[model samples]
Target: MATPSLQDGIDKSGSPIELLWQPNAEPWLPEVVDREFTGWRQEQAAWHEGVALLNLSHHMFDMWIEGPDATRVLADHGVNNFEKFAIGQAKQYVPVTRDGNIVTDGILAREGENKYLLSGIPAAQHWVQYHAEKGGYDVAFETDPSSAFRPGGGDPKLFRYQIQGPLAAELVQRAFGGPLPETKFFHFTAVTLNGRPLRALRHGMAGQAGFEFIGDWEHAAYVHETFLKVGEPLGLVQVGARAYATPSVESGWIPSPVPGIYTDPELADYRAWLPLFGIEGKRPLNGSYFSADIEDYYVSPFELGYGKLIHFGHDFVGRDALLAAKGSETLRKKVTLVLDPFDVRRVIGEDQDPGFVLSYARHRVESGDGLVGVTMQAASIDPVGSVLALSLVDAEHATPGTEVTVVWGEHPGSGAASEADLGFPRIRATVQAAPFNEHARTLYRRDR
Candidate 1:
């Protein structure tokens, strides 16, 4: 398929918010503030040229959860306790169905003592509503469907830029004047750039030590331009969504509208919010498909690599179900698969390409009568000597050295051209532990 493109234009009558797009660039909102100094499209182009700068257009959301029982309200959901989350601290987790199926993965922030910001898939709103109804808590919510990161009211829109990699910090510090000496991972400190107040967070979705800056749209152009001055000097090129998504997969972060293993009413609500949240659309982008039947899409927490994070101490959604099934019934397990180097090379049609093979939800041809379990996310051509993938497999299939077939290429030939065809590659592989790229990620952030 040809590269998707949308032109930048102003929407004066439809909504007060203004948007800009280039015929050749990925669709963006709030307008491209600075064409010369900082263009998200230019940043995307840099990724193909060796360096990477990702726009992160869909992975983010802006929302607010309010009401007196807000804290208790969220607790009733699958979110970990909010009490431990100090003001300005961010927590990430997946919202599970009453049946314990994964509904949506979200990031929550405590903006006020009684109010919180929940951003991720719009399906998260259903979980919030379900909690309010069941817990009888007077809670409310506002979904910022467009993940625009606007700070302060005067600015109609917001723009954020993330600079990552080994030299990301130095380049960012140069743009802000002096150095951003005191920012910690997942923590933010406010600063003024080009006469506009901005918040800089030492956050990296790409698993690299990086910085994300948030500010109003009016000042986006100036802010973007300023970054280029520092970025160009430091050889920091703009990366695209593809480059950034690599780390997310390697880290086992599933995209929104996570499929669940069990069926439930929450599935309908989840479907309603899919388009609003930007997870599933008319044209599917990734390997996962949207299922109207919740049963076909249930995801056990174990399958999501959250088995260790599940604490049964407090009363929360799916608490009883999860606990009751703990001892007796068997729960699904999530495991990683390491592909043969030869097969990996053939799959992407690249000889010794450093880029990893992205995981997809489509059925994978494996070995034996046992079918390949749901492959949630994958990253190939890893620096860690193998192509890795995360999969939710049956109890028998979840084990180290479990001989599994990856199905690299279809029927006859197992080469680059055959792998690129619409059909399966069908390469043989084996099941291992969770987190295929944990080692490499740890190496990247050794300092922090």
Candidate 2:
């Protein structure tokens, strides 16, 4: 018999949004290896000044889609235009509901003529597989679930690592023992490292020049150790999970959003198909932006600042809805919230207050009288001398100097009752450009 999912025993009597905040709920990334190898502060510095290497083989899952109709299946389900997606190129794959609400976004790469790899959150992958099986596509899929899902699932099919910083290219050149191949942003090339085949993708999480090196699991240790040996003089710091999450704020990448797949009548069948223990079923919505209607939580790609990736040239799911929403006057825009330095200190200083704690994840952002938006990720990038958060706000309030208030405490019914009972704390914040780091906006996509 299949093991009952975490949601099997959940009390479904309340609104779906409320059930998400139950104290017993597990985090979306439950098996996150949260630790700082060289310390988080230093790791943050490494990404800016030197080079930072991150081990991404465990936390995120990977799905392989291959067969003659692989590209067709992807083009049908994703909002991105696959017509020009070359084999060596990768793009951010965004899957949406028929109503144009974003389901989830992840990294998709075409490995060969009929082979593709999708890596990131499991929710999007599951959606793709369901369609592939039911749509009668001539495609096959193999998934390497995350460690949290299959504790002893054995060695992963691939080992993933990211190296990013000003010196990243130099380190790669030295490791390859020659000039590094010229690769465009989001494109990759094959190279040999220590006599082993390695595919290096020109990508970066921190919005700096970098490469993502991936290969068979067997070569993981060899590749990591070799890079460390060669990178010793280049100030290479191995980033841990804690620091690994900080870049999203600096790079303007929204890491977590409640997958907008629930409450749509048309998607009832898809919801039924998802395992209760899967990411979609168990992920919680804990921020202060509470709403009885689940639709209030749904977001479109354009609202998330992915308008450039949307193409209406071909018909696809949610194409019509996106077309109508494109350039709409009420469209939400992404921005960075520079939290008031003094107010931030107050929240951290309140540690002496009994049962007081501040949450840095998915806090609610509001204007004077109403909730205008919510923050997706927050971090203290000390090197930048300000606590930063990424937010999607009403266009009118998204100006670089617009002021807003961020609810800093947990919801009243979320997590532990004692912690939840404490009223929400408010912090002053000012809206800024989404890519808070100037280098990310200007130099991020420039080819070396």
Which candidate leads the pack in lDDT?
Answer: 2
Task: Name the runs in model 1 displaced over 4 angstroms.
Answer: 1-52, 57-59, 130-136, 147-156, 181-184, 256-262, 265-296, 325-329, 344-359, 379-387, 395-402, 408-425, 430-433, 439-448
lDDT of 1 at 190: 79
lDDT by residue (345-398, candidate 1, tens digit) is 666556555343444433353557445465665554334556666666777777
Q: Which ten residues in a row are the worst by lDDT in model 1?
A: 15-24
Q: How many angstroms is residue 66 displaced in model 2 relative to the true structure, after the best TM-score fit?
A: 0.9
| Residue-by-residue lDDT tens digits, candidate 2, 114-133 | 99999998888988998988
- 103 Cα displacement, candidate 2 (Å): 0.7
Top-scoring candidate (TM-score): 2
The alpha-carbon deviation from the true structure for residue 270 of candidate 1, after best TM-score superposition, in angstroms, is: 8.2
- Provide the RMSD of all predictions against the true structure, rounded to 1 decimal: 9.6, 3.4
TM-score of 2: 0.92
